[model samples]
Target chain A: MFAEVLTIGDELLTGHTVDSNSAFIASKLTEQGYWVRRITTVGDDVEEIKAVVGEILARKPEVLVISGGLGPTHDDVTMLAVAEALGRKLVLCEKCLERIKAFYEKLYSEGYIDDPSLNEGRKKMAYLPEGAEPLENTGGAAPGAFIEHKGVKIFVLPGMPREMKAMLEKEVLPRLGRRKFLQRKFLAEITDESKLAPILREALERFNVRIHSSPKGFGKYIGLIIFAEDEGELEKTVEYLESRGIRLEEA
Target chain B: MFAEVLTIGDELLTGHTVDSNSAFIASKLTEQGYWVRRITTVGDDVEEIKAVVGEILARKPEVLVISGGLGPTHDDVTMLAVAEALGRKLVLCEKCLERIKAFYEKLYSEGYIDDPSLNEGRKKMAYLPEGAEPLENTGGAAPGAFIEHKGVKIFVLPGMPREMKAMLEKEVLPRLGRRKFLQRKFLAEITDESKLAPILREALERFNVRIHSSPKGFGKYIGLIIFAEDEGELEKTVEYLESRGIRLEEA
Candidate 1:
């Protein structure tokens, strides 16, 4: 299956925040044998988000994972954008409200908070799209939501990396079980990438592999990746490279 | 000015590579007072690249920064896709050839290597669009290229973070100078973010501020960021908060 990640936040665009959520989601989706086709980061603008979502959906990716803008703030407009993109309506989820209220009551009883802000933060999590499944969030006040529209599953997650990760692991992964796929990575300690062209070409000719070479730190080391759909084919390609004395390392 | 970043590579899509180039470009663009509207990462597939480029151009961003797929591998199809997107022809550049050859000669004179792979690598860097200007790479074998198409200035930098960063700072930044912008960050030591909502809303009401309350480890503290376009307004808002006995720590 193919997927695309949409990270929404103006802070990311203004350099006030670094987008670690996309990287984290990409890694997890890849580990689960899903091809994360594209990642798009947009500001909190509704028009921009809608435009990007439309473009991504046109590409026909099976899954669309979105992170950020799920807080109790003015800039948190991800839910509205998602509803607009999917041609749906925003509705206050009763279950989500109950969960949020329960969380606030627990926090108040534990003396963590004593003011009305607890209910305010909890209320923020209650707004979601119609016919959405609220994912349990153990890390923060915002509960994630998942909605499937026109064969594309969209997951709306929090911008916080820890909370996004926790929800993905606990809620998203179970729904998307294992699939048949292959991924191989090679780490080479070569100083020059120019010298590896012929070897790379030869490897590609022998196997149906997508090869990517990325140099790091003045060409101190280069990361070579080989992706394929068949596991045996991937192994054979790695073995062929090993025979040519090109060291193969796993990521 | 507004900008968009396009990173092309299968390794990025398959999770074999973590794209650091977009983050680096975003930070640089932000520092230069340019709003990075979106950062789109896609595979090396030509159709995917074409689609993203088309959408980005349609949005009419002032600048479009592209990284990755500049290598000599089979999956290195960014140049072709870019050419197709701009309706331009891929042509070998004479100056780029001289630069690449000179780079190889320098390496050879320094007793690095006398292999023919150097020439191949240089030839790879010499290929450019018909009217594109080649950006020199003092760090690696791949030289970047710059093209202005339909009012959107597109820069093609190597996927490697170091090379992309060096080229962006040395070439891209000086061309696109600085702009006046206001950025304010406050670190609140409160374990509960609920206590800060009212004050945050108050700060926003006083100034055009977007506050991001990022809770850190075990709810120890919430890092607050208030970014605006007016420095005086931000200062007034901060002073108001401080005067109200709301402890504001400079970030």
Candidate 2:
């Protein structure tokens, strides 16, 4: 399966927050045998979010994971954007409202909140685009959401790392079981990668494995991250490279 | 000016590499007064790279910063993709060849390489898309390239953090120059942000400063990142929030 991740936040766009959400989703999706084709990030602008949703949807990834902007803030506009993009009406999810109320009630009990009342902004978290199912946010107030648009599974998760992680494990993971990736890493101590290029190119054409090389300064070492699902073929490639005087550190 | 960043590498998409390159470029662009519109990342696929290049170019961001995939390996396909997208030919530049030769010669003198001869793979780095200028790499072998397309300045830098940073500072920054961004961060300890909602909406409406609020799990605190180019507007917004029982920490 192919997947795409759209992360929304000005914090992420401005570098106030490094987008660990996309990486986390990508890694998780990769483990489930879903090739995360592209990861797109935009600021907390409804129009940009809506436009990206349209674009990524056109690309037609089987699964789409969107993180951030599901907060009580004015900047949180993912729901509105998704609604507009999917031509769905923004409606209140009663279950989500109950969850938000319970969250505030717990805060009230713990003396974290002055009142258990759900104010307008807090209540807004309960609103989801039409036909959206509220995914429980065990770690926070705003409930995460999931919707199916044109056969694409769209998951809207919170921006908070803690909350996003918990919900992803509970809600998204089971939907995508698991597919292990077998990658063989190698660090070749080479004086010049140019010397090994012929071997690298030949190996790439000859084997099922895909080879990637990162040049270390002074041509002393080239870090190679090689990917091959077939263990036997990978071993043969390793042996072949080693036989050609490429000192490979099978990491 | 509008800006966008594209960081290319399979390592990045597959989660083996965390894309710090986009964030670094985004931050730099933000500081230079460019509204970094969006950041898109793609794996080391030629078609993917070409498609994104076409899309982002059509978006017409005045400045587009591209990092990664400029390596001596077979996976290094960004150059080829860019050339094809722009209808440019891949041609070897003599100047780039001289630099490559010098780099290898220095390595040979230092006894880092067994041979100083520039193989076909090493020479391949000199073959840039037509009309592309080599941005001298102070740290590595592959020279970074720069091209101007339809008034958009496209900077292609190496993926290695060290090389990308060096070239960005030396080659790309001067072209962009600098633009200052004025921002104010505040921590508002509040029982309910919903209570402050009216004030925040009012503040957002009345002031030129763009207000962004981040909900801290409980209704205990809300982190705010506000942006204002006008000094007076920033002060007015700050004062108005303080007057409304919003305990503000000028972070």
What local lDDT score does residue B41 receive in model 2, on the 0 to 100 scale? 94
Q: Which candidate is the best by lDDT?
A: 2
Two-chain DockQ for model 1: 0.45
Local distance difference test, candidate 2:
0.85
In candidate 1, what are the lDDT values of residues B25-124, reduced to their tens digit? 8878877777788888988888889888998899899999999887655567788788888888889888877766776677767766554344465476
Model 2 clashing residue pairs (backbone): B32-B179
The residue pairs in collision within model 1 are none
Cα RMSD of predicted structure 2: 2.5
Q: Cα deviation of B1 in candidate 1 (Å)?
A: 2.6
Task: Assign candidate 1 its CAPRI class.
Answer: acceptable
Model 2 spans > 4 angstroms off? A177-182, A216-221, A228-249, B177-181, B216-221
TM-scores for every predicted model: 0.88, 0.92
DockQ of every candidate: 0.45, 0.62
lDDT for each residue of candidate 2 in A200-251, tens digit (9 for 90 to 100)? 8788777887777766665577888776767887888888888888999876
CAPRI-style grade of the A/B interface in model 2: medium
